[model samples]
Target: MIDPQQATPRPDAPAVEDPATMPFPLISDISAARWLLVFIIAAAIYFFHGFLVPVLAATIIAFASWPLSRSVQRALGIDRTATAALFVLVIVLFLVVPVTMALLYAFRELQQWIYWVFEVNANGAATPLWMVDLPQIGDWIDEQWMRHIGRPGAIADLVQLTSGNTIASIYRSVLAAGNVAFHLALNLLFMLIALFVFYRDGDKIAGQIDIIGARILPRRWERLSRVVPLTISATVTGMTLIAMGEGVILGIAYWIAGVPSPVTLGVITGIMALIPGGAPLCFTLVSIYLVASGSPLAGVLLFLWGAIELFIVDKTIRPVLVGGPVKMPFLPTFFGLVGGVKTMGIVGLFVGPVLMALLVAIWREWLREIRTHPQTP
Candidate 1:
């Protein structure tokens, strides 16, 4: 019933628009705009979660290997793109190929071990002498073995009593292994793809990073840049070399101690040494195997040797390599190593320490700025 003129005559009143169709209405408020931008970015990241690990891996590889790429570029008088492609090819051929081969070997060994277990279960492995020689638990171990595995149908009975579905459990474990292998292959594929891209565009990306970094942290940009590359190189090179050394040393010990699959165990130990506490675990398990097999003195000596080696490396070699004055604080280093592993697995070891180093560097620089700034009059 309202007149059209009267309804349209309110010129003195402020104009209002429908919220749904108003283009970028939130952009009018800077805080809201910033939050929206952040939301958009977060949403994008969440959407691409599948690629995140590969992205992280590629970035780490790119940053860590940039110097080599540049050197090759300069030496060969080739373009950056060519150099990057070459670097990627080299990485795949040299690094990934070797790792893949090692994995295959490890997998074959695992299959053999599993088959051995099955064979032993079917044919009843003889109880080791150590089980009868223990001071307190020897009798218990012997009894348990005799009750569960020494008899013909004992294992099946024990497994039935413990869990009604042995086949199902084994099936699930096999499926899990398959899933892990598939995911690993997928991630590696993404990593190589991303790595090639990063290597090619790394200079442009670095420039952009420099710009953003300088804008946000003008005073610390130069130092941060220098520190980051050094930290990456040091952490990667140091950790890798030390792990190799530990592996070689431990492998020799394993051989001398007559451990089965000494070479395989050594490779596993070296890889494990990349993670904190991993090396200790590797050697501990081996020692336990020795102890369970009745070589108590050998077990004790091997455990002691491994413990001492780990201690020496951690105290002396690790500190010198990863903890220079300009490098990371211990707490950050620890967190980085732990959190990286938790979140990203093996490659995280290198990524974690370098990221921690960057964070520590930023923190230190910030504190320095605060301390050196002029006081108000």
Candidate 2:
């Protein structure tokens, strides 16, 4: 009886809402389940705070080495577990073993230095010719040395910082060393275990994270995810290569300048070069030693060489290796390094750059979005 085209729904019929036209709810309308989930997440984070450092370190290491891990796994046609075991073994053999040996050698050197200090303090000695002959500051240094280190029992006073008790101070120092060693061992163990797990299941873990990331940040996840690993790989590789180059180059210079223990000094300088200003401090101290010890020309030359090399590396090499891929600027890289060291200690060196890279990526993303959808005033 009615025209079908003009027919209208009955008044009592249920209405169907169009999802695309639905307005977002206000914050006040958030559900209790979401609040409960957030609380649970916060509680978990609070509880697992202690594992943060080692876990983060492992994560960074895993991310950096993932490509190499994949290549090795594919080449060998091995299962992930075997590949992971081999990876851990390689790290232990190449990194841990060498570091342990270096630490032991350094401890031995420290022991000898301490013994010499004790002997010097027990029996006063004449000022060294080099100290006496040093230009301008020579006399001042000689006088200070005679007062502090050249006199008998002066070293005892230096160690009496805690409650002015020499024995107590030494006891506390030993206790502190043991505590540090224990904690270090635990961290290393946790890191290795975490590394193995990460190596074995990194792909699956990454996939799970991608799923979550998509759900949380549907628009930006792909770009942000790609940026992190590239940034980490670039930063770490750049720093390490620069450090090794500096060490090798400076070690040769040390030898040419007749510096004692050139190899050891090179190793030390290389290690120090990881931190900003560290390499300069090492070379500057050594150069001063050379000048004080009657090789002023060599010292001056060494200082000049170090300055030039540092300038070249900083200006030319670092930007290409570290910043080229991420499209990051030098200032951010420098701040990241300094800030990371300030807040996170050594690990921050890598983490800091990564955070900055993410910031840059997000900024660019926002810019793109703005360009794509300019708002009408």
TM-score of each: 0.69, 0.70
lDDT of 1 by residue, 1-377 (tens): 99887776566888788899878753468788779889999999999988888888788778777887888888899986788789989989977777677666767767776666566567777667866877788889888888888766566667678888673476468557867778778988999989988888888888999998998889778877887776666666666657767887998899888898787898889867765666899999999889878788999999999999988887777778656423335567678778887887766665676677667766776787678885677
User: Deviation in angstroms for 316 in model 1?
Assistant: 10
Tell me the alpha-carbon RMSD of every candidate: 7.8, 7.7
- Model 1 spans > 4 angstroms off: 1-33, 118-126, 134-137, 140-167, 218-222, 248-258, 275-342, 345-377
Candidate 1 lowest-lDDT run of ten = 321-330
Clashes of 1: 0
What would you estimate as the lDDT of candidate 1? 0.77
